[model samples]
Target: MLRESPYPMVSVSEATALIMAHVQPLRSEEIDALTALGRVLASDVVSPEDIPDVPKSAMDGYALRAADGLAPRRIVGELTAGGTATVAIAPGEATRIMTGAPMPIGADAMIPVELTEERDGMLYIQRELKPGDYVHSVGQDVRRGQMVLAAGTALGAAEIGLLATLGITRIAAYRQPRVAVLATGDEVVEPGSERPGGAVRDSNRYALMAAIREAGCIPISLGIARDDIDVQRQAILQGLDQADVLITSGGVSMGTRDLIKPLLAELGTVHFGRIAFKPGKPTTFATIGDKLVFGLPGYPVSSLVSFEVFVRPALRALQGDATPFRPQIEVTLAEPVRPSPDRPEYQRIIVRYQEGRLLAVTTGSQSSSRLLSLRGANGLLLVPAGETTYPAGSTLPALLTGQLLL
Candidate 1:
């Protein structure tokens, strides 16, 4: 049996703004650069020293003066990588240098070994050489005192390699948030457990945990709490104590047994009780002290969609990520579809490139309980509330959730 709720619903934008208004970035922590992948940089990283501080050879060739081009020169010395030139080269003199080797003094250019032939300790050039040819000048890659990475930048493989090149083994990065997941309702049972009549498997907890991990946050499971107010209260208090954010499923709706919203009011300030969004209308947000709490719907799809629309961005913001929202792109609908009558809907769709055009096809059945609707879905097509139907070839903006198919 459903019951009426006294809380007023807020628009999606209003709810998002309200949630972000309270979010604060976590403090920075010193971590090894090798382990900083996917972590947000806390401060700008400046190059302490120029990359390739000294002029080096860019190829395995003979280093010689360009003025002596096409002139048979005697090989004065051979320099390998990490080896320094002990002697300077004069006119009619050359040094056999390997790739990445420091250029010999007075040597202004390099001629590839393939382009020349060596005989009787003399090197002959097949092609004309010019000054600065095949030579990596000082600070060619990066200059000293230059900003290499800006604050709030997410570290990736290339960033880590750059850090190593700059001799930065340690870095200051924003700490990843720890999220606590709590499953409620007496009808929920653990997976792989024998279910009695009227019992359903607890997929929401596992799904939410996976989503939390995918967002680069730690997930702590608080097990299950029955509809009992006391049990739910204790679990919620424990979650708030152990995690930076608390997520509870199955107790935010307008029902007689929906005690999470009321308990959140007693424990903290409920910023917004509901949102005017489909698949997650009963979503709730609150703040208890410094910790955040999100009450999501019980359905599997609703739980995941709510996480994508709200919790994910909050997690990214807590890590100081500059762009906390998903990338949005314009997509053309491949087929006609009816829009929701009231609140806006985020329809899951599979996006692909066909004939040089990006087209989207809706997944069958947008029901909140059907988790399969999200399978193979790469974008969420935003359908506005209207009585008219959207015809085929209608263009709309969609939030990209994954890579597009070719």
Candidate 2:
């Protein structure tokens, strides 16, 4: 259960500030080197030793003493990679060394073995040998005591390969936030289950599960809860007790069946509900004890948007993510859009590149229950709730959901 009220009703910014003011910094966890791709490193990892640790040959060549190799050369010995030096080069002789073979003692340079000719136990140098020619110097690719991987760098294929080169077997990363989801509604039933006369298939929970995974969090599903307050309370409390965050769809409104708000008041104080947004107007969030509870509307689109705005950021913060919000860009509408004076709208839109400019076309219908409207949409066009009848081709600001310019 939460403590006393921090303040009165706040705008989105104030509410977010008051809510996130005291969230503890994320902690690091363990990750095997192989499974560390796409995870941020928890600490700086230096190269344990100089890469390639030895001055080796880069080509099939002959190792010889530089001062004695002014002219021709005689074959003295052969050195394969991993083989010890059995014979050393004298003044006029050279050793046939394979690629990656260690430079032998007293050998100051390497010449391509093919460049030498021999007759009657004498070696002929077909080409001039320069000091340090064809020899891979020690630590050319990477040096010892170098800070190869900085802390907080997101590991990629190249980073992983570099770590492997340094013999890093494992690393520390931030533990993924554990999220639990519950769907509550007397009219809700599992998808593919027989929907009784008044029941609707449970799609929001599945959508939320997918979204949670995409956001890089672990989703622990607690299944569905019915309309009864006692059942919903028990399920919510149980979820909060086990998960770092609890998300539920439905029962957050003021309807007779709505129970999430009252339960939140009984447990912890409600942070805020009913933000100034369309389709997702019923969005509600609270801190149930220490677990964040997000009450999403039962409608598919509304629930998805609520998760996008609230739970996604909280999960990112819990994971030590530097930037939790999606990218937004300004665009001109291809056609006019009339917006409600009451709630801001994130209208689904299709974007296209025209003459080096991005143009957006709104999809059919703005109803919160329409799922197909968002299928091919690249991003949402945010229209302010205070405006109406935006003119076609006007420079009304639109939020590009795909990227963050910064």
Candidate 3:
């Protein structure tokens, strides 16, 4: 016999708040700076010394006093980058310097080689020069004891380059969370295994694994567990022991065989067992001794959608990201769509820029079991529960998932 779920269904916002309340950033660890790309800094990085501590030439030209304008000066010596200045310029004298070479003691400006002519060891300047022109003065780019990067800032290519320039080889960064995925059902089998009648290949495990990786978390596969309560409990226990977050699919509904909800309650606290959202109404969240557990629906589309709506943000929060949610933008619908009568829907859409406006079109069929609906989709259009049909050109807000199509 089917039994009703004991937990009341809550709105998406309520569920998100409850989950976030339990989530906290992980502890920091020292790691090599070269491997810190995409990791959030746990502490501020201050410059130990000023960038370009000495005055350097910004162009390959002659370095001389600005007072000697457009005058023929004797080129005493040549200065290349990484070579020390052997001769200093005096009045009516100049030195041939390359880009990034340290300026001599008496030189105050640089003229580009393109604007000067060299004849018989004499340099003739074509353009008038001014002091500090084409010269990188001391501490011009960065000052000493200045905060170059703040805590909670995500490291990128440019940030890594800056750290290299500042001689910062190691960094303190938040540890990436490890998520374990468990697929439960008696009718499920591995992809390579032969499928018998009434048996289906397991796709949720791989899909959830990919989604976890995309969220910047490490994914650990817990394999599939049978519908038996004892088997599911053992699997869940092992998963909790090995991972910081646990995600299970196919046993969270109200069916008699559905056992994840009861098991979670017994093992920990179930914050919310159901959401008032379509395609993922039975999604459940819980906390087990500082670890998080998410029980998602069995359908492929529903599982992925729930991950995007809930798990992704949680992972980001664990890494101390200030903006944990996906970016949301207003978009215009390209066709008519019928809203769910009882619950709000997250419809998969392909968003593109049409002329000057952002237009979105729904992937055909919006069915929870059709995983193809997510292919080439870049946004999730939020449709409110209503009896009326939303006609073409209706403007609504959507959560961005990927790059917008031009």
The candidate that achieves the highest TM-score relative to the unseen native structure: 1
Q: What tens digits encode model 3's per-residue C-alpha lDDT throughout 87-180?
A: 7899889999999999997999989999889999999988888899999998899899999999888889999999999999999999999999
Tens digit per residue, CA lDDT, model 2, 41-109 = 778888878767877787987888778746666777889898866776677777788998988777878
Q: Candidate 3: which stretches are off by over 4 Å? A: 1-3
**CA lDDT for candidate 1:** 0.93
**Residue range with the least summed lDDT across 10 consecutive positions in model 1:** 1-10
Measured with C-alpha atoms, the lDDT of residue 106 in candidate 1 is 93
The TM-score of candidate 1 is 0.96
> How many times do residue backbones clash in model 1?
0
Clashing pairs in 1: none
Q: Candidate 2, after superposition: displacement of residue 3 in Å?
A: 27
Report the lDDT of model 3 for residue 24: 95
Q: Which has the higher TM-score value, candidate number 1 or candidate number 3?
A: 1
Q: lDDT for model 3, please.
A: 0.93
> Residue 104 in candidate 2 has what lDDT?
79
